[model samples]
Target: MFRNARLSLFLPFLVCVCANGAALAQSLPQPASQNGISYITGGVGEDEVQAFRAAAPGYNLRMTFASKTGSYLSDIDVTITSGAGRSVLSVRTEGPFLFVRLPAGRYQIGAQTRHITETRKIQVPAHGGADLRFYWEDPDRHGVMRVCKSCPDTARP
Candidate 1:
């Protein structure tokens, strides 16, 4: 009888925890699909951004967009193409951050806003990953572009 009472008391707590967990899970961002490419694309909120960053490593590339003054920018166009110039991933994120899964290879990553387009070359390791950051400056305020450490930009076309 005592054991039964203990379980009965714990049951309410368990139910409450499970219900809260389900709600939180539902609030998390879900993977999106565009042009047959499946990607995780949301980080507008504080918690959602944390979740996105936490889940980033599993993806092949983490693309982030920001202004020249270091302000986060959203809805920027991002495109990933193979070394042979084939489109691999093309997406426009609602937030400043986007995570995509690509096969290990060399590719060109292009990020564009209304007035500027920044391009970088990246080579995903056969066993590791990479990060691409686009800092968009104004037309006249443009400066040197930064390349990913893992991938070298040997040639610019």
Candidate 2:
């Protein structure tokens, strides 16, 4: 009888803990699927940034877009194609950053915003990953648009 009472009390506490954990997990960013590709694209909030950082290494391609003035850009369309020119994944970034997982190989990445469209060729190694930065300069300013495959990460705004 005493053991039964103990379990009954402990069960309530365990239920509460499990319920809280579920809520916390829901609050974190989750991956999205499109065109048979599963990717997570967000950097708007602290939670999203943390989620990207934690998952980026597992992905072969990590990307971010910005203006020549160093302002982050969003709502950009990104496309990834294999070395043979077959489209692998196409996604639109909701924030400045986009993270994607692909089979280890060579790919051409293309990013397009209202201001400019840029393309880059990159090789995904057998392990680890790479970062790419697309600088979508303002056309009015006559600045050159460029993509930096090895650019350093700037301070998160």
Candidate 3:
């Protein structure tokens, strides 16, 4: 009887781990199938390069402000809403990547930093994974979007 109970508990633990495995493998935008409207996070595909472009929804977006160079942005406002304008995840900082799971629909993507506010639309497939990066500028500086290469994944965002 004790062995049976232990097995039951261990079985559930394994199932849960598998269920959340993808969440651990990646942090942003889960993998999706075609049909749903998903946001292509980071600067992935800005154009309609994929064959099933219209059949699905997605976008390649990037916010460039402090990302130019040495100027590290202090604050950032990223508002991710569903197709119906329902609130999803509203992030406010230059931290780690953010991932939100939705039933695939129209979405409004926007970001605001010390001196800029940008908004755009993204269509995500049923289960497609999108990539997006927000780079905030400082006042009036222009340069290349530089990410911290030395930044460690184990490090806190």
Say which prediction, candidate 2 or candidate 3, comes out ahead on TM-score: 2
Cα lDDT of candidate 2 equals 0.78
- lDDT (0-100) at residue 133 of candidate 3? 52
Clashing pairs in 2: none
For residues 1-157, write the lDDT of model 2, one tens digit per residue: 9999999999999999888666545544577776666677768776566656666776777898888888777899999998998888888888988887777888999899884789999998878888999997653445433368586534323
User: How are the candidates ranked when ordered by TM-score, highest leading?
Assistant: 1, 2, 3
Per lDDT, what order, best first? 2, 1, 3
Alpha carbon lDDT of each predicted model: 0.78, 0.78, 0.51
Judging by TM-score against the true structure, name the best candidate.
1
Tens digit of per-residue lDDT, candidate 1, span 13-103: 9999888666556655787766566688767777676677667877878888888778788989888888999887787888888888777
Span of ten consecutive residues with least summed lDDT in model 2: 137-146
What's the count of clashing pairs in each model shown?
0, 0, 26
Per-model TM-score versus the true fold: 0.69, 0.68, 0.41
| Winner by TM-score between candidate 3 and candidate 1 | 1
